[model samples]
Target chain A: MEKKDKIYEGKAKIAKLEVDESPNTAQKYGIMSIPTIVLFKDGESVWQGVGVQQKQTIEAELNKVAS
Target chain B: MSAQYKVVILGTGPAGLTAAIYLARASVVPIVFSGPQPGGQLSTTTEVGNYPGFVEDIQGPELMDRMRKQAERYGTKFIEEEITSVDFSKKPFSLKTSTQTVTADSVIIATGASAKWLGLDSEQKLRGKGVSACATCDGFFFKDKDVVVVGGGDTAMEEATFLTKFAKKVTIIARGSEGNLKASKFMEERAIKDSKISFIYSSEVIEVIGDNKVDSVKIKNNENGKEKVIKIDGLFIAIGHKPNTDFLGDQLELDKGYIKVKDNTKTSVPGIFTGGDVHDWRYRQAVTAAGFGCMAALDVERYLEGIF
Candidate 1:
């Protein structure tokens, strides 16, 4: 679904699953904010964060899920 | 000499760029490391007024863009990378960034401070929509609208007082009773005297509520387990700011989590100067940061004169 919804596929490392125009996906995930990034390794959320976070934070989270 | 610059300025905010402009014009050939957020705090802001030059006003990012271009025009070399560590113990200070390590004869610490937030999920969601950390920067957008400010310190008092000019009603959410307020006598008295300003003692903002924009805030009493929702048009977090000196690794002196400077921008160690929000706690304005940047540049030039 994110493959169809994502405007651009900048990096192929991680897939972006967004439900911007539709609120159903957000409601399902209890997401109430924009720029909320969630890391999923095996169809399950491993880590998540909100707001405009630093690159270090995102990289650390990605490393955690990857490990 | 294995390639050492005359000076290296950390950060790309108003202060860093201004220093670069002065340094480049003087032919000192300064290198600037623009940290994670290039253009710093100003990039997050929408409009910039009281910056002195632009009478018609300009966007915050736009103002920073012009400053960066001006610095570049003067031959200021820019690096969009983060400095992971710095070794200022010896001459020709070594800096390790995300990409490469560089050395500079003199180093200017222009890394600006960041505003503290409540770390609330809803608060994070509504940022730039109706929630802001700076009253002076975003209060104009809340004209004649009800707003709330968080914090019990002098910063909160100052923000609440400043918001009165634009907000119809300003509510201060202090963590404890009024007696627990950390504000000074004059600042507290100023807010207390303001007709538009009100207080909610022994309270904390638990959650922010809104769909498109902020329409209300949920606050909880510290003593009791009761929560109340108040309609609000805007929210300001006046909990103060933390300086960007983490990478210094206890090398430079810090006073209350901020880099301490004397005679404007001179740090405790010679040839190592600090400018912008990293040192200026009284007025964190862009203009003042630029002034500090100018001072740091001249100080570095004079310091380099004795070295080479």
Candidate 2:
């Protein structure tokens, strides 16, 4: 809830991919739009959020999948 | 518990950032809430040649990012959070983000407007693949390809005209009769004179057919109930936009969903001000929005001075 909360940060590994350079990865993920966030669990995408999303929404999604 | 601030500016558009620049320079130290789209609608745009000062041209996102940095250098604190709701009746107005609550003495609402979608399932699925709401942002991708522009308003005409520079052919799909267009004479004539632009009257895109990209669209006639499919490379929905004011509830008066402003930037609520596309449907340019932001900041400064 606070900015200093590192609980969720410690549980997940975040990776940023450049869709331009990694065309294969982008294509594999079927990423047609910019700023597409895909949550992967065990090398599979469980949830995907497109465009701008609220922090709480992402946190809730993360909580659902992480559990 | 909530963080208290003297001034809180919503949105990170040209308006909000410009307000921050002014307020921060005046030692107001306003906290800016960067809504979902940090750079606002302009971020989705491509080339911005008419914002003034720039000799050549700047990309939409680049201009907004520079504005944000300028505001940041001047002591403006930016939070990448959107206010979900607000209560303006209280002395220090309360606002809620998805996570926590915050309070501000004065508020500037520059949340701007968002494009209206067709709400079709297929349209949602192929948004970025080949369907787009912004022709300026996605027109280049349809170069040498055919595309369809939906709507009968000036925005629809403008988008079709702009697309003609890139797309091989641009088709206008109007759900109303041919004579029942909402576009002004100037805009209609400009679009009509374009050789690459054509119109399909009294028709609607029932479905956007595609797999990964837009292949074609299923259009149905409103009069005779005739259905037809036209192959296209991209679909542009230019139906128009709705202001982002759901969070305000009944705290402020709104005109057709846009916040109503009086005395330049002051809204119906005394301490609550507005700028940009949220209050201005006409002349929704970045420069004009920034000007509004500047005015709102000045008004807020005067209002705060009187109180303090």
- In the order shown, the candidates' DockQ scores are 0.08, 0.34
Stretches of candidate 2 exceeding 4 Å from the true structure: A1-25, A63-67, B136-146, B161-169, B176-197, B209-216, B231-233
Off by over 4 Å in 1: A1-67, B1-3, B118-149, B152-172, B176-199, B205-236
lDDT of 1 by residue, B1-308 (tens): 34578899999899999999999999988899888778988886666778998888799889999999999999999876788898888877888876578898899999999889999999988886788887766676676889999999998998898889889999999996977788888898999999999999999999999986789999999898799999998899988788888888888889987898887778888889989998888799999999999999989998889842
Show the lowest summed lDDT stretch of 10 residues, model 2 chain B. Answer: B134-143
Q: Write the per-residue lDDT of candidate 2 for residues B1-308, one digit (tens) a residue.
A: 68999999999999999999999999999999999899999898878999899998999999999999999999999888999899999879999987789999999999999999999999999988889888886676676889999999999999999999889999999987877899998998899889999999999999999997899999999999999999998999999998999888898999999998888899998899889999998989999999999999999999999852
**Native-referenced TM-scores of chain A, all candidate models:** 0.67, 0.84
**What is the fnat value (0 to 1) for candidate 1?**
0.03
TM-scores, one per candidate: 0.67, 0.85
How does residue A9 of candidate 1 score in lDDT? 41
The model with the greatest lDDT is 2
